[model samples]
Target: MKIDSLTSVQGQQKLFDNGNARVTKVDGQGEQPQPQQIASTIYHKDDPVLPANYGTYDIKAVINENVEDPETMNARYNRVQELFGFGIAERSVDLELGYLSGVESLSQGLRDKDWGFSIQDGELQVIEGSDSLSDEERSQITDALKGAGVEYAAQSVANAVIEMIETERSPNGLSRSIGRFDVNQSNFADVVDLRSFMEDYQVGGKYGKGIVNPNDIQARYFGAGTGIMDQVAAKADETFLYKGR
Candidate 1:
């Protein structure tokens, strides 16, 4: 049967007039019929479609407007401290004490799996761990510190080793004498035995006298004082006793 000769031809034309029909055109080169482009549908007020709305907002601007400036923030903080009868104990860090700084670095170095140093009995030493530093590694670190304008670089490196050994926290959260020093991204040419270096010197364990290290004494007092203040503030006229550790 021919398509045009069908009885549904009139019904199909009526469907097309009502926008319910798809039209196609046959290609001239014996290709399949292709769909004709259709005009977009215009939605009316009665159409069942949800409306979409979009907008942009500046959150940073809102935050900045409400935030207080640095000076004002500091003033408010100080005022609060005064109201609580709290006085902050400040300690000046003397970078010139390169030995102390080195010990601090030692703490950091051991934490970072780097070279470790220590200071005991008025002497400073570096630990020779299982993975000892090579000559090339030592030279690289020395060069880096020198290039970085680190004064007393040698002393600092040695102290870092001491800090790791003396205050190196154990797995169980206690201090230990023997600990490994590991450095990453550094190569040393030769490894020295720390034990041999301290063979002539004796290791001091117990501090019979009062706190020797000024820094350590300051820290103990500062910590104890802070706790006292806290307790005094909370108890309000109640006495609290704290013995130095």
Candidate 2:
């Protein structure tokens, strides 16, 4: 962690002739260190959406869909793929991206600005692209950060942004990936449509349970008709493929 002050020793120096190696304070005798509470929210796709439109929630935008900018879309695609399961698929996608403009660094990858580090949150954080920033460059950034209503650069805002990003990763929700403003849960869920082989095979959902709502696609193989299950699946595949097509 970067700090304002730091000191390191090159060699050992002793001020006292003797030292004591004993426990001075018992556990909980002095002020206790409290765990930092993450003041952010999380939810599942199927869970209730409370605090609806409450505060300035993050709106996730999928590349090619919402984030249509060529450079930015391509630049931020790595985050989408790393956080979300798939990258930009031909299939439709609408997601609420966390940290679209917060907690930025000199990304070795794509940058939002032409040159230098840029964070497009409430305040524009611009770090000049130079090995050693000049006095003018430093003043420019400091003044920019001190602008009115520049809440995005604040630590609280940055924390909230991280919370939302973590939500969309593996432990993400269907609604979260589709929300205008939402967060992902701490788990993962995937699906597959059956127009190919093994149509009758079951795919379990979270916690190894059958999908809460089954028979949702193709009417469970176009109505599992009265016949051997395997035969029904085979016929359904053929029907959906040759007949429907």
Candidate 3:
């Protein structure tokens, strides 16, 4: 939150005395007061895709596989997952995997003019990369984003590139650790999959009223029979080995 302007201490004091709306107030007799950053009121009603309180949605209904039309049922289920759950898995992985390194690479690319991107007045712009982009490459990027229904695809590309670059320059402490753990120590996909399954279990227990079992949903989704279930149970048991110890 950066303040855009400054005010006099006397003016701030007078404002306080008059009970006027307060911004940042400087101390001392002659000091100038810098205005505090105000929170932005602007928000996009449609951009987030899911509701803020998405947890309240009827999970069982959303994941229904028992509908008469298999194609319709699959489509409906897929749509729900895309809108609310697993569809973002790959993107989430991309955003997490080698995050720091990818960012560094992107920054280096930008600096070397190998990738085309720029920031001016806090806004990202996609310019020509160092080696000029082929028309085919440019068209491919634009077309793919357009196909995905992204508005302002060029700007989004620029922003994403900039974010990746900036992220490499200064990634969060926890993210750096997590990225390392995922890359060097553990199977990231297994972790994400297991977490998703466990989350479904909790969601079912909370709202299914004995009707929805997360394992049942997993079985259906993965075409897993009893043998697979047994193996899954074993995996789960192994994962929770220290739970009751």
Candidate 4:
């Protein structure tokens, strides 16, 4: 029962000396003994959290980014022509069109968007206007033209559109330039419509008497790949034959 009295206290202290064991002090004033605090195991407890090794985004960000910049959007527009092209044709678009500047806003309506008109490096806080194509406008224009499935004539149309918007600033000029592109971006192979040619031979009006839109001739006996350039002069009759619909 009396353990302390039975034990050699000094020899016991030598046996249990693993350093700093927790203990409590008891006072005669009927107060409960309070436990002593222990030192933290980790040395750097106040350090900041470590950063992640890879980029991360939420569902909202994913949706927003996809909508703002599609990976690739298939472009298809109905081809309207009075000549042989009175149907549809396959078209291709640029992949980088989505990432072009100002495409998110300007593609909706180029005429409606306002330009931050500055006279000389933010000097003139004048009236708002959409008279010119800055970098933003240029990007928007290129995106639109390229995304419209323009090929071969893309450079010329883009140049003409950019110049018109930059210099002439006329809405009519802009519209006409766009319409002019419709002519240039044609699927019609610079040839007369077979139906129109037949009609002209019978009882025609406009498409007759060499008043053709393209003026190049197309017939059952004739062939495809006939344009301003045959594109493949040697193989025009072989590779690019028009299977008449």
State which candidate has the highest TM-score. 3
1-245 in candidate 3: lDDT tens per residue?
10011111111111001111212322334234243222111112232222364222221111122322334433332332232233222222222122212233222333343433222333332345347866665554334333433323223322332232122111121111111121111222221222122222232321223423322332222111111122233332232121110
Model 4 reaches what TM-score against the true structure?
0.16
**Which regions of candidate 2 are displaced past 4 Å?**
1-126, 130-132, 151-157, 169-245
Cα lDDT tens digits, model 2, 1-245, are 11101122122221111111111222333344323211122323333222352111233323232313334333332343222211111100110011222213223232222223222333334344335565765454445334422333232322333343433332222332222222212111001111111122123312112433332222121111111112222222221121110
TM-score of each predicted structure versus truth: 0.18, 0.20, 0.20, 0.16
Give the higher-TM-score candidate: 3 or 4.
Answer: 3
Model 3 lDDT at residue 158: 25
For residues 76-178, could you state the per-residue lDDT of candidate 4 as single tens digits?
0011111111101010011112212223334445534443211122121112344555666655554543453332333322232223222211112221111
Every candidate's lDDT: 0.26, 0.25, 0.25, 0.22
Off by over 4 Å in 4: 1-130, 152-245
TM-score (C-alpha, index-matched) for candidate 1:
0.18
